[model samples]
Target chain A: MSDTQTTVEPVRMGRKATQPLLIVNDLVKTFGNGVKAVDGVSFTISPGETVGLVGESGCGKSTTAKLLLRTLDPDSGEVKFGGQDLLGMRGRALRRLRSRFQIVPQNPQTSLNPRLPVRSSIEFNLRAHGVPKPERVERIAEVLEQVGLPGAYGDRFPHELSGGQLQRAAIARAISTRPELVICDEAVSALDKSIQAQILNLLAEFQKELGMAYLFISHDLSVVEHISDQVLVMYLGRIVEDGTGSQLWNRPGHPYTEALLSAAPGAERERIVLVGDPPSPANPPSGCTFHTRCPIAIEACSTKRPLLKPTAGGSHAACIRTTDLQQP
Target chain B: MTVEAQAELVIDAAGETSDAVLSVRDLTTTFTAGGQRIEALRGIDLDLYPGRVSVLLGESGSGKSVTARSILRLYGASAIIGGSAVFEGRDLVGLNEKEMQPIRGSGIALVPQDPTGSLDPVRRVGAQIVEVLRLHGVVDSKKEAQARAEELLGLVGLPDPVRAARSFPHEMSGGMKQRVAIAIAICCNPTLLIADEPTTALDVTVQAQILDLFVELTSSIGSAMLMITHDVGVAKDLADHVSVMYAGRIVEQGATSTVLDDPVHPYTKALLAAVPTPDVPRGNLIPIIGQPPVSGMTLPGCSFAPRCPVAQSSCTELVPELVSVELGHSVACPVATEFGAA
Candidate 1:
């Protein structure tokens, strides 16, 4: 683990010296039905940094990504990308900003158009960004090759390609615009394990070559752990813990984070099986939302909500008992 | 006896005779779609021993699900299935729908992948389980069936069994619906349970709970389980025996620890290596090159030879048989079997 950490040291050190690429401050989004999908989440992503956002179903991880991209307008928050207020931008302004940001969704099968060939799908993004038609073909071919697909594959439809091939094409489309940031919302989750590794490795290689920041969102912790520099653990529309991959994986501060880390297969940590499913976002438990399922929930947990405070592990954890719990 | 000792005792009891609740040998299934015969499963050999879990591990289109479906004779008229699936001295392969009726739920039950899809959306979750119980004749009275359904709901760790029983499949969350599906599958106390990627659609925490429920229920009932999944972690966590499938054939079969920890077949090794594990450092995965061959695509020799890292000339000339490398461990690569020993 240390050797792996050392290998990624240069990437971390290079990014730390530079100003952050994107800064999300107190972002909040509540649906029409009174479901607070994202609540008061704040994080920063540096240039070429891969931030892994992990949570279970309805944990607001996807909602946060949507809010960042302004796909769904945030109820209230500040999203500053490249030092510009992204939330303030509208219409043509927002569309202009879109060239700098792109998203690769979970299912490549649905994300890609069945009617269009793989080349057109990638070219569509380039076309939208006002790239000349002459350059689109070359860019598409270059991206396809970068993602490990043959240039000839550009002629095939989505149905003609396998799940892995389709995902690579989806990635090719996402990166074709040469966006500064790419929000991959479980982009590799739908693919097979073998293909998942291929995609993960390709993403890592792309990050090194192009120096693009990634908002890698997924439910799979191992995938997150492998790719991310900083990992955020969300529970019930709130950031329960924010730390590095090693910090979250090796020494998770929040009980929810701890339970999640343990739940991941092949985790050597002692299993802390959280009882029951996550409470509905519309009807989250009072005080500490996780108290209902927290293994170490004290009386204070139900009476008072915990604030995200700095812990010994150089991570912020929103758990009242963070100091009391023994470090892993 | 203590819990650990008791668990060991049960394992020993099951291991003594190595009593396979279902023994599938040389099972093949071919589907004729669009005037083309596609081999979905080719010579799949697996055995599910009582009180233990045997996992059919593979990616989509690898015939893991087909194997489960074939065991129950669930395929329609167009499917041409061959070979034997001996359950209780009866071959399930040749059985017609009418013949398989009794065996489907009573002898073997399926907890399908998509819980919502498998469940009756119109019916109440409780009523569905009760219907299965009544249809299988597991319970005589409606009152008894209702009571049993509630008990099963509780057994699956569903909160408020009464409310859960009254709610429809659409009303329940994905995890709850899956639990209901599991409850329905186990209501009859079948000797063998076939869960096809049961937790694939679930969240990690929910998946852990469901898997824990499966282990607890199956152990207590002394039921053999055939757990099909593409996830290596799930197979590692749950399976006693693991069968790695590629292009509709078993490439490797052995104890979970043996196959996962030290795989022989290049495909198996590549599959394990490809998975992103917490222990493994970032950016270190060596992904298997090339996609699995599409169904109906003819391969001259080994199906995995095109993508196999250590393939030689001979690997492309002949499809190797599953040769024993160690006790209870077999690999389908002649090169690996011969060289992997060192």
Candidate 2:
């Protein structure tokens, strides 16, 4: 990046907490094999807050992450980041906007370039975003320090680092770009328990320091509840429930969310063993996609496409019996 | 039998002398890699009783899987096995391939972590189970083996056993594949069944179902289970006896409720505290301060001393051994042991 190039800033920074950092509405995507991976998913994320998107495998959380990053284009709907129409942006504009949000991938082994030293991966992001050469050097050292890695570790290759260290390096690379939002798709799920806590703490620390929002995605419900302020449960390509972590933990409105809570190992609640395998996303069940496995699902649930509605517990759920289900 | 072994068996008060289906004593395994011997298991001891689930709980490098594999003699030429693993009054440690053949499936069976890796991808799920049944001589004919295969699938809670038996490994979901794996493992009615993180790859709801199946099948068949997992919740859910491993040694072992609720070893306490559970509030997880020692690295003292909160000056010099804290509960921490004694 050269001085005096005078490139336009893609995103205006420093928004109030009331305004959303990322707004996704009715996003839809279907794969080549006709799998409706993401089906009309909609959510909003405020700056400096963490929103957990959780579900079992094949529930479209990864597809949603890809669509939000524009790595995979959604077949329909809008993704507005920092008041700009992200999906409508052209080549240079889209590339310029890329630095505004970044990803901390699940597995750092594949995400980080194995051949290059850790410094180069972080430096690559800076250079691509047009950070000056001198600034790039400083940012690399700074981010590495912020993530609790020693300055000397920048010289080491990916394989030299442990799983936890690689994840920290992944976080350093993501934050080196100074992105307003970081999407952590199963970031800590791959790590061991003791190491997982360290990474989670680092994320919380960085979020407070940088004031960046996070779209934390994981199959582990407890980890999601621990890190996220707001929680969204997805089943068969749809958001079954959305609420604050406390609301969903105490009084889950959707049967899928309730079943998920019960199924968690060591969860003291009565086990609701959902029989049969999850149906293929390509051939999802009609109306309520979870009706096939929901323990409390009524016959009407299969016929009616229940919209996201507010429950008595102040959380929004997409179940007809959301109000009456949580009576004890 | 050795005179010392006979004396120890009679004096052992933790469990009934005749109850154990498998008794592992001072089991150690070492592998020669790059001309360096990696001591994966270091003087481990365990007693697996019939109709009970004993969980070996630890992280990846803690040698939980190695313990299970060593019992079954899964390692080839690279591994140097030490100590004894007695199953049904027979020592399994020194047995050759031919001698161990009959014991492998009929005496003991394993349900590995990944069903996809364990199951034959090309063969139908039923054919695989039938092969195990016929190979073990559990059933007389192919016709009887086929019927037993479908019956075993249904026992593991596969809703449609007939259809599941016809499908290939790729055709079934992770949960269903795991069920098939469980079905094959329990088909022989082995006295000892080892499940290595059986539900780790499946969804939570599916994990619950599989856990339920483990309890039901183990009790009904009157087989002892040695379940290996890193998840504390999984151990809490299924384990009747819990053994916590750290840096290739058993740090704690006791009844599940006693060990999990009143953890004596600092490592066990820290591990249980660190895990994010439904009851623990957000951001309250107290992470263990340091990394676990590199696997196979010889330690002079307790492996956990570097990270132990209540480490004493002597802890750096003294290697802790499992000392009884209560009936059926033992902790390998000198500091904790002293406290319990006091």
Candidate with maximal DockQ: 1
Tens-place lDDT per residue, model 1, B66-166, is 89888888887879999888787678877778889999888999999999899988999999999999998888899999999999999888889999999
| Model 1, span A212-297: residue lDDT tens | 88999999888898899888888999888888888877777888888887887666677778887899999889999999998899
Clashing pairs in 2: none
B104-172: candidate 2 lDDT, tens digit per residue: 888899999999999998999999999999888889999999999999888888888999899999998
Best by lDDT: 2
- In order of listing, the candidates' clash counts read 0, 0
Cα RMSD, each candidate: 4.6, 5.4
Model 1 residue B157 CA deviation in Å: 2.4
TM-score of each: 0.94, 0.95
Q: After TM-score superposition, what is the CA distance of residue B146 in candidate 1 from its true location, in Å? A: 2.0
